[model samples]
Target: MKKMLIVFLIFAFSLSAKEVPSSGEMMFDLIPIRPLGLAALAIGSGFFVLSIPIGLLSADPRQTLEQSARRLVIYPLHFTFQRPVGEFYGYMEEIEYVSD
Candidate 1:
């Protein structure tokens, strides 16, 4: 009975074992980005940044206000107030403008 039980357990463990497929058999393929691809990405990012101000200027006042509010919330503690030229001390300032 002990030998039979050990054989059964071995068979059960073997049945539960899973076989992984080779890398070539993977469903998704990863492609490396070339230098040209990176350059294109940089150019696209620059264009996106340049377009924001143009869009803001062309957009309505309400949209601009909403955008400004969103920016303030995203960068809550960004700006600091420094003495311009002849002041003795520097101070940290909350640079956000909240609207009603």
Candidate 2:
């Protein structure tokens, strides 16, 4: 019991003796103006507010793809197509396919 107490005291004293800076030394001498940080926060908040209406106004993927193809392309990509036989599942699972 005494041996354990002596070991604990020695360990505690050794830890406390390590060089720890005073609060004055650890504190920043010059604080940042942070204009950029404030600007970023403002812009992010604006975008968050903007996204709520934009998301509601956004068209469905199938309709958007169809419209884009009709307005500006030789062929339009369709999202409602099925997979070709013997193709790997992972290879084409997430791609938008166009009928040629």
Candidate 3:
């Protein structure tokens, strides 16, 4: 138990001493943001599946499906995986361009 505690303390100190900018942000992103993003992706995918029939039935199925897919599914997927660690704004711009 004592040895384990010492190892844990060392690991914690190492994390704090790293040169990475916004380590706190990275930790926050890793611990909560990523998981929440994944959850959003899952929930959005489910919603997209449910919206499929409506999209197909719309006056313009292609447009409806494309918009819905981008909003509900692709956005979360990109935010979750493609965004750089500790950097938040770039992915939104990318997605905006893609949507346009």
Candidate 4:
């Protein structure tokens, strides 16, 4: 029974997982998610500015500031502008900035 339950759970999870976005998801992302992300970006930028002095006081000031900026500003910017339309996978993952 346990084995069957586990197998059923795995099958159900796999079937419900969406790797590709449908047209409806694309439309929803464009119409609503993007705008909300933009708003969040703006708010986060403001908070980032306010955190600068406090961040500077940290032992590892540079790392602290960079982390704050990445979380508050960069992630939102990526979600709002850089991310592909309707791709929600990046939302839950850590974003790393790769410099060329």
Candidate 5:
């Protein structure tokens, strides 16, 4: 009975293993994000006003604000539109690669 149970458990585990996607499927999943990026940029631009006070409190007000704006608006849009369609390779690459 113990041997039969072990065999059954192994068989169940094997059945749960899924095959990997084909090259085409993988490629399809990596399409460029031009539209999405543009939208995020617009949304982030609207939030710039919210960062003003935080920026003012920092030692370098203008630069702090600029950095925040770049992170919130510029970088996301740039990476989304310009990056390799299927790979993480630029500024945000480390965060993305590690997360995925």
Candidate 6:
């Protein structure tokens, strides 16, 4: 019983001593901002829009273009959609599994 009490006191003291990373400091961590990814996403969307004109003008691989469009849209969307819930895949904040 004494050992358990001592352990509890030590644990409490350690928790008090530990400083949490500020939410602001970890803001980008949750959403991993990538300018390049955003740029590519924009370019892909632009090209997909341009392809619409080409498709209207002549023969075009509609199926292939659809696949490419999906790929392009999905990559950056992945960052937006996947980065938040790092532990679970969709929720906002990361839940700590192990506490100090």
Write candidate 1's Cα lDDT for 1-100 as tens digits: 9999999999888855545544543322112223333454455556556656765776485676466444432232222122122222222243345757
* lDDT, model 6, position 20: 55
Which runs of model 6 end up more than 4 angstroms from their true locations?
1-33, 55-60, 85-100
lDDT of 5 by residue, 1-100 (tens): 9999999999888855545666665465354445566777888877876888878999999789877877887677766665545454456654432211
Model 2 CA deviation exceeding 4 Å by range? 9-33, 55-100
Report model 2's TM-score to 2 decimal places. Answer: 0.31
The segments of candidate 4 whose C-alpha lies over 4 angstroms from its true place after superposition are 1-20, 90-94
Ranking by lDDT: 4, 3, 5, 6, 1, 2
Alpha carbon lDDT of each predicted model: 0.44, 0.42, 0.87, 0.89, 0.68, 0.57
Per-residue C-alpha lDDT of model 2 across residues 7-30, encoded as one tens digit per residue = 999988885454554544323211
Q: Which order, best to worst by TM-score?
A: 4, 3, 5, 6, 2, 1
lDDT of 6 by residue, 10-78 (tens): 988884354455676445545555555577678878877777666565555675565556666755555
Could you tell which candidate, 3 or 4, scores higher by lDDT?
A: 4
Candidate 2, residue 82: lDDT: 33
Judged by TM-score, which candidate is best? Answer: 4
In model 2, how large is the Cα lDDT of residue 52? 52
Q: Best candidate, lDDT-wise? A: 4
lDDT of 6: 0.57
The TM-scores, one per candidate, come to 0.25, 0.31, 0.72, 0.73, 0.47, 0.39
- Predicted structure 5: lDDT: 0.68
With a 3 Å backbone cut-off (N, CA, C), the pairs that clash in candidate 3 are none
Q: Which stretch of 10 consecutive residues in model 6 shows the poorest summed lDDT?
A: 91-100
What's the lDDT for candidate 4?
A: 0.89
Question: Going through the candidates in order, what is the number of backbone clashes in each?
Answer: 0, 0, 0, 0, 0, 0
> Which 10-residue window in model 5 sums to the lowest lDDT?
91-100
Clashing pairs in 5: none
Between the candidate structures 2 and 4, which one is better when assessed by TM-score? 4
Off by over 4 Å in 1: 1-33, 60-100
